[model samples]
Each structure stands twice: as structure tokens, then as C-alpha cells.
Target: MSDTETLNKLRGVISKLARELNTTATSEGLTPTQASVLGLIVFRGPLGLTELAQLEGLNPTMLSRVIGKLTELGLIQRDPNPADLRAIQVESTEAGRELSDRIKHHRTEAIAACLDQLPETTAQTIINALPALEALAQALRSTHN
Candidate 1:
């Protein structure tokens, strides 16, 4: 396929996956952004406000509000940054980590079940493509940095 065609196909697949994940997020009573931010904190945290905002493509004010909401829910905590006393760092609480892990388990199980219905060869092909897919993801992520 042409590069444009390949890109379009990738976009369609990604959009479908995102919609599925969004449904799961909403079912847990969190906005997609809130779920995303929480997951990021659970996995990549002790993140400063500025770094988290940049990673999530959120403006600082908006990120702060999200942080406030998460804090109110007791899913995350913001403390003084050890590296920069004036700055704040955020990390997930135990409850937050548990919730994130639960969500991830559900998503993984759902995908695995779907894969089980595919032909063996087709499923293996998808698994084999993961490294290339990850490289593509990293390349895309770098573009936003």
C-alpha cells in the first residue's frame, strides 16, 4: 500500500482502540483525560506538573485542574518536588494504582479474548508486528516532544 493508505489504516485502528478504551474509562466514572493522567502517574510518576502537562498535551492550568480533581478523589497526591522545592510533583496513591491496574487488566483481557477468535496465523502475525508497532509509537511520541 502507499504510505498514505498505510497511515489511514493505522489511524482507523488506533481510533477504534481509543474509543474502546474511552468506553472503559467512562464506565469507571472518569473522563478519558482523567484516566489517562492517572495511568501516566501510576506508571511514570513522581512527575512534575510541567512535565506531566507537556506529556499529556495539556495546558498548565487545565492540568492543574485535573490534578485537583484526582487529588479530591484520593487517586493521586501532589507534593513538593524534591528536585525543585518550588515545584510540585504528582504520584498515584495506592487506590489509584489499584484502579489503574484493574483497568489495564480488563483491557488486556478484552483484547486477548478478541485475539482468540482470530486465526492462529493472523494472531501470531499481530504479535510479531508488535516491535515494529512500538517503534512507530515511539517515533510518533518523539514528534510531539
Candidate 2:
């Protein structure tokens, strides 16, 4: 396929995957953005609010509201940033990590089930693509800065 065609295909697949994952997030009674924020903290956390806002593509006001909701749910906590006394850092509480884990489990099971229905070769091909896909993700993230 042409490069444009390949890019289009990738976009389509990624959009579908996002939708599926968002559905899982919603099933847990959280909006997709909330789940995404929680997962980020669970994985790459103790992050400053400014940094988190950049990573999540949310403005400060919106990010604060999300943080507030998560805080109210006892899913995450904010603490004074040691480096910058005025700024705060956010990290996942135990409950947030637990919820993130459950979301991951559900997403994994759903994907695995679908993979099982695919031909062995096709399934293996998709699995083998993970490294390249991860590299692509990294490249995209870098470009976002």
C-alpha cells in the first residue's frame, strides 16, 4: 500500500481501539478522560499538574476539574512539588491503581478473545507488530512536544 493508504489504515485501527478502550472506561463509571488521566498517573505518575495537563492535551482548568473529581473519588492525591513549591504533583492512590489494573485486564481479555478468533498467523503478526507500534507511538509523542 502507499504511505498515505497505510497511514489512513493505522488511523482507522487506532480510532477503533480507542473507542473500545473508552467503552471499558465508561463501563467502570468513569469518563474516558478520567480513566486516561488515572491510568497515566498509575503508570507515569507523581507528575506535576502542568506536565500532566500537557501529556493529556487538557487545559489547566479542565485538568483541574478532572483532578478534583478523581480526588473526590479517592483515586488520586495531590502533593506539593518539591522542586517547585508553588506547583503540585499528582499520583494515583491505591484505589486508582486498582481501577487502572482492572481496566487493563478487561481491555486485554477483550483483545485476546478477538485474537483467538483470528488465524494463528494473523494473530502472531499482530503480536509481532507491537514493538514497531510502540516505537511509532514514541515518535508521535516526541513530535507532539
Backbone collisions counted per model: 0, 0
Top candidate, metric lDDT: 2
Question: Candidate 2 residues 1-145, lDDT tens each?
Answer: 4699898998999999889878888888899999999999999979999889999999999999999999999999999999998989999999999999999898888899999999999999999999999998998999999
Off by over 4 Å in 2: none
Which one wins on TM-score?
A: 2
Q: What is the lDDT of residue 91 in candidate 2?
A: 93
Per-residue CA lDDT of model 1 for 68-104, tens digit only, reads: 9999999999899998999989999999998888788
Global lDDT scores for all candidate models: 0.90, 0.93
Error of 1 at 14 (Å): 1.4
- Candidate 2, residue 73: Cα displacement in angstroms equals 0.6
Model 2 lDDT, full chain set: 0.93
